[model samples]
Target chain A: MTGAVMNPAWALLAPVVLGVLALAGAALNGVFVARAEGRPALSGAARPVLEVMRLMRQRRRVTVAADRLLWRIGGMALLVIALLKTAVIPLGPWILADISVGIVWFNAMDVMVWAGMWLIGWGANSAHALAGGYRFLAQAVSYELPLMFALVTPAVAAHSLRVSEVVDAQQDLWFVVWMPVAFLVFCGSVLAFSAWGPFATAAGADIAGGILTEVSGVDRLLIMAGRYALLATGAAFAVALFLGGGSGPLLPDWLWTIVKTLVLLAGFIAVSRRLSAIRPDRLAEVAWIVVLPLALLQTLVVSIIVAVRG
Target chain B: MLSIIVFSALAIIAVASGIAVFRVDSMARATYALAVSFVAVGVMLVMFDLDYIGVITILMMVMEMAIMAIYMIMFMGMNPALMPMSMVHNNRWSAILATGIFLLLAAGALLVPWPARSGTAAPDLTVAVGEALMGSKMLVMLTVSPILFATIVAALVLANPRGRYDRWGDNLKRVCPDDPQQGGLGK
Candidate 1:
């Protein structure tokens, strides 16, 4: 199936759709939290809506000598990066901006999180916030290489960097079936970049919310929304790269895309809750020595298979 | 017409932010201003259909700048990097040098006897560019990269204070390596 670039007018819908998916992820996360705390699931699902309303009314917390411009920009950049990522991700047969280097485009956007998270911490001018920012960069140093290798595996298999071609290559056999290591590494890196679940040390409670220490009101709202949006975007990308995007029976292609993304997103949220936070310092050795090599091996295996098939 | 407008806008941003790198007081701001300048240049490359190079430029520059800002702040003596501080020093001579270089480059651009295009553009500019850069030297490229990586790994191993002997035992017979901090693996 040829993936056609949709009308430019549909570009506006990217953020709206991303926002909805993010809301669903948040609701799923809320459900997990509710079950853990022994609360009603329905109420937990509606909690994000109430949170938005509450945060909208709350006053923004201003820090002494804070770089407000950078702080605000950092908070807002996450959601913008998520939306930019969505541009390269096709929903079934339709895409926005069908660039030839879509995989690299997504990689570029994810790397922006390094700058964004650091600025969020640095801008607050608070000790904890700055520390949180540094922690994220440290964690990033470990995860970034593995993530890049994982992305390269799919591109190597498809012999194309375009998202549509990657999806098309998976029509016969899902890449996830053979490249489980890359798939797992991709999922883990998505969590790491989003600073969610086990990788949430950058915003850990021990550091008094870390990069989130000084933010409040709409600033806090934006950062929180950005985190969920990144998670949703990562899940959608994983579907396209590994799950054979829109290749399911009975349902239309677009619907299948949505369904697969939701399922993966839910898995992400639930799994994150199950695992405890990993300290960045501790993670560095394991990531580099173990995870990175595994990821590289996965890429090597995929490349060999592709070469053999050809 | 639209391409012209976009190109001009990006060029302006690149220059403005490049200037901002020295104008900004804080190290973080200066570092990110440089990042913005690079990002603008990267987008301009994308406009020229160098998609892979363009996107990789944005990826590398942002990551480099982020790390650089951290080191700049962390290693700065007297904590001046975190405080309000000038991003420039010896500014007068530097300005003169910068202007001299700019004029030279601009003159070269304007005066160079550039030949008119003789061949059609390739179907994929990324592949074309890659072939142009590496087609003949593919063996050298592949060989040198591994040696370079090996050197880096070797250097790090030698420099590491807590090597395997230190972590494990001198005889390398420890059940759990004695360490200052526990790793995620717990092994």
Candidate 2:
């Protein structure tokens, strides 16, 4: 069905699908984090993976030298900033539940990630933690450019920074098809931005667990959850931009949207599983040398195509 | 019904994950929850007739968190997932502050004077949005690409640790004498 044809059934299915995919994504992401930490996925008696949260909350440990107040604030801020970013997301037809600046708002929210991370790393009062925080700035600076280019490709094609408009633009053709190069670049940036595999050096366990090393108690919880939210948010954009929001043949619009989202998320999980963690220096290399050029080419190509087609 | 379903789904995930961001016991878990919450919110954006923004929300958050999680592991020198750590601090004040902010925002939402719908929601809001963006804000579209390209080149120049000497020999035919591998030329 075309965008002109509104299917309510699909709408219902979309959220449900998104919810399931989200849960799965979370589970998968958690599994990877567990693996990287050198814990068994599932162990006898303890269910090693499941024991993760249980162990974290069981006792609170804060480094003696860390600043208690900033440490705690940093933790809470991590989640809050993530949520703030979400406030502007356009789900389906309900724009005003809290919708504002669409994609721009989401980009603005990213600043929170830097702020919260720096605070947590600084508050931890450890050299490694500080270094991780410092490296984050470097990594952030490198990847963010490509990420932004990838993001704008869709906006350029759809003619709007507003995500809803971009999805609507897919009515005739999914942006992914029109701008295949941009879609790949965007996906790559998402993976890098999330630090899923190749670009995970900033917080490498060897370096410090970098930022969160000294954090403990409820503070750790906040930081971790914030990271998950970031992943979920990133996955949502993948679905919206490349896959086309809620588009399917038999399924309701929403359901189709959800299915697409989960499918993309599965890829995220799969990639997360297969790739080795990237060191900070290497992340910079890939982001600058590889991702950057590709993104530039993508934007240029998409613009030319749009110009020619229009 | 559609609105309710969409709003509720986005709100639940967004808020739950928002809360979870601080509620989880470890740094990694918190990051994941935050990402999920943001994804939910992005979905909501799609529902809101703001497709462009909604998709962006998802894309931006995922990359940001992945990086954050890795940094958590590397710098900490511990398996971030396995190591149990406290994630909360300033419980009483934070709770109070968060709650107070929530209430204030809620009140503003409820009390604010909302604008009336003008000209029956654009037949296709996306098209309208696209036209407005490209027609009026074309400069952003024009400028962003080049700026991004420059940034990429600058990043490359700044980040690399080695140069041609690090890879090739002085003669450009044979491998360098200081090569670490036994057969530098792959012979």
User: Which candidate leads the pack in lDDT?
Assistant: 1
Which residue segments of model 2 deviate by more than 4 Å?
A1-23, A29-56, A96-101, B1-187
TM-score of chain B of each: 0.78, 0.61
- The TM-score obtained by model 2 is 0.58
**lDDT (10s digit) by residue, model 2, range B27-81:** 6667767877887888798787776577677767865775676567566535544
User: Which candidate leads in DockQ?
Assistant: 1
Candidate 2 lDDT at A109 equals 61
Docking class of 2: incorrect
| lDDT agreement with native, every candidate | 0.94, 0.66
Local error of candidate 1 at residue A258 (angstroms): 0.6
Error of 2 at A268 (Å): 1.2
TM agreement with the true structure for every prediction: 0.93, 0.58
Predicted candidate 2 versus true structure: per-residue lDDT over A1-310, tens digit per residue: 2123334454454434334444566676666666778886543223333434664666777575565555676678756765565444444443322332466666656645665666677667678887777777666767677877887788888777666777778877787876776777666656654545655565777885888677665666656656655666677777777777766687776566556666777687678677787555546656677778888889898889889989
Please give the lDDT score at residue B85 for candidate 2. Answer: 66
